[model samples]
Target: MADDRRKNRIFRGSLGLLLLSLVLSGGCWDRRELETLAVVTGMGLNYAAQGDGYEVAFQIVRAAQLQSASGGAGGGGELKPVWILRSTGPTVFEAVRNATFQSSRRLFLSHNQVLIISEAVAKGGLLPALEFFVRDHEPRNTQWLLLTPDEPVEILDAAAGLERVSALAIVDLMKQYQLTSKIKPVYLADYIKTRIEKTTANTLPIIRIYETAGKKELLLDGTAILKEDRLVGFLDHKETRGLLWVLGEVRGGVITVDLPGGGKATFEIFDAIPKVKVEFKEGRVQVKIEIKERAGLGAQTTYADLSTPEQFKKLENLQTKAIEDEIRAALAKAKAYKADIFGFGEYLYKHDHRTWQRLQKEWERYFVDAQVEIKIEAMVEELGLVTRPATYRELRK
Candidate 1:
């Protein structure tokens, strides 16, 4: 009888321990349901016109509406897939927290893909506005950082073309920058990295809203040049590509040059490799950029047979001149602004530390007066499917 009582006690103890284990092993004690959170895909910062605070805009996805749209629900009463909310505070952190007062659910930012800053905020300085994002644990560093002249909220609210959300559309645009190589896409991390450098400046693609056919459209225009943390000037598309060439970021794009025979030919870039050398000579900084590029004949406006050896050589010369001109233009702009966007100062610092140290304090003066030489070797490898223009045979006939 005593043995049976001991067995019963042991069984009760085991059962209690099992129940406790079950309770403790259940995870997600503080997990919030998806319906209780607002998913923010894009965040924009701008200076408040009425006050000395920041105006923060968020592009929140309407989960249910997006689902219904993807599910092929055809109803005229369907709602939009995103909502743009604006909030204001004395600082970015406070502005973010202030959003909770307007939003019923917490604003979630882990899914954010783009961060747009207005020209006003960017011109004032990015460190003050970007501190919150850099210090926060939730915002990712991979998000594309863009500058805009228009209202940040307006850009966020612009139509997204095929995309349901404008922010995602902006992300797609950034990914396809290699197609034109005219805009340099800068991420939050990239900006931060350049900012940490003492002499290297930074660049960010410019995003703007334009009206086309009575519809608002988003466009990635030129580029914003920032010296240190403040916006200094801008670069046009051609100038931006020139900057890309020096940075060895040109992958795929088209270069059109006028032929000596009074027609134009467009060459699609297959490969381009830039070799840059920064030297201190004659008590001045000299930068030499040699770009070796290979391209194929994409299209021609003339009926001349460009496939011939003589004509191909001429095309290559023209292509080389075109590239050199672009680089020179970009260099001129950079020197005018006294901005070392090409990181020549950093190059000197790494290769010749003593020279960099002596000039680091007055690097801007050295950079403005720096002598730059550009050399381009362009090759026309392919002539596409047809040797001559399609109308060449007809013209010969």
Candidate 2:
């Protein structure tokens, strides 16, 4: 027993010594000072004009700009919010290392909030360069991912007024869009998972940058369709809502219902809860989607009061039609793209694996011709007891 205890003590002593020696010898082998790095706020990747090459562009914020005293990504005091660094490499990681040639500090990615890629690169295939992203612990999975119609550099360079720098502005812009719009937020982790599942597909938010009067601005183009890992097509604002509806991701979007009179009434959705169901019957798949929502009347064109059940029913029917129309629009787009990004196939896989495997073989062909029926029913419970529908309602010429 004594000898056994002695052996245990020896093992502990040896481990401690080994750890101590290693810790003392390592000496910050990977250490790089903050000043040594450009501190990347965003990154953009494109195809280089060579064989198996890529152009990786970095959006870096001067660390001093991020410090409150130096006017970080939020202030305006003669400090640039972002700077650009570009390099060529065979892969994304190689491009990242090459960016260091122009900077004194190692690139910082922790604050990176948005990643924009060119449409060509995205259509070519994103899964290849994306592998390293997941393996590396530095880049976050929650960061917003956007694809640009133009070269990613141009979009990355667009100056936004909200954030001190363009990179931060894009991030802030995305947050605002999500908060006020019905657009679905696509993240790296979710995107990759959808691509890997085979039963599901993925989408990315698209951004377009334009310049006027020496200042850059951005626009949310909509959603890009992905098949396997390649972008097949894009969805417009209405189509995006359709996609969001299918995925049950609708949060808030203004819905305009053509009223019985001239002009239109705008209803802003406050809450949306959508449910999807998939079932097989008689050798066919049926997908049923249900969306329940509450909305505020943002505008009214005619004299109408919401205090009556008749008005509620009228608005409910109109909303249902409007939502269903959007859903149909989205369905038409997905069918055209022949990709089941809404994961209707995923629902099938969950319910019945045996059929899903068979369906997986010819999923594209089936999706192209498959019948996806969308049913939307919305109810207008209250108008918040409005004294008047709109200023125009009480006005007389």
Q: Which candidate achieves the best lDDT against the true structure?
A: 1
Q: Which pairs of residues collide in model 2?
A: 36-104, 36-105, 37-105, 37-106, 65-72, 73-164
Give RMSD to native, each candidate: 2.7, 5.2
For each candidate in the order shown, give its overall lDDT on alpha carbons.
0.91, 0.78
Error of 2 at 73 (Å): 16
* Residue runs of model 1 more than 4 Å from their true location after superposition: 1-30, 392-397
lDDT digits (tens) for residues 46-99 of candidate 2: 888787878888888766655754533454555555788788888888888887
TM-score for each model: 0.93, 0.87
Model 1: lDDT equals: 0.91
**Collision count for each candidate, in order:** 0, 6
lDDT of 1 at 168: 94
RMSD after Cα superposition, model 2:
5.2
Clashing pairs in 1: none
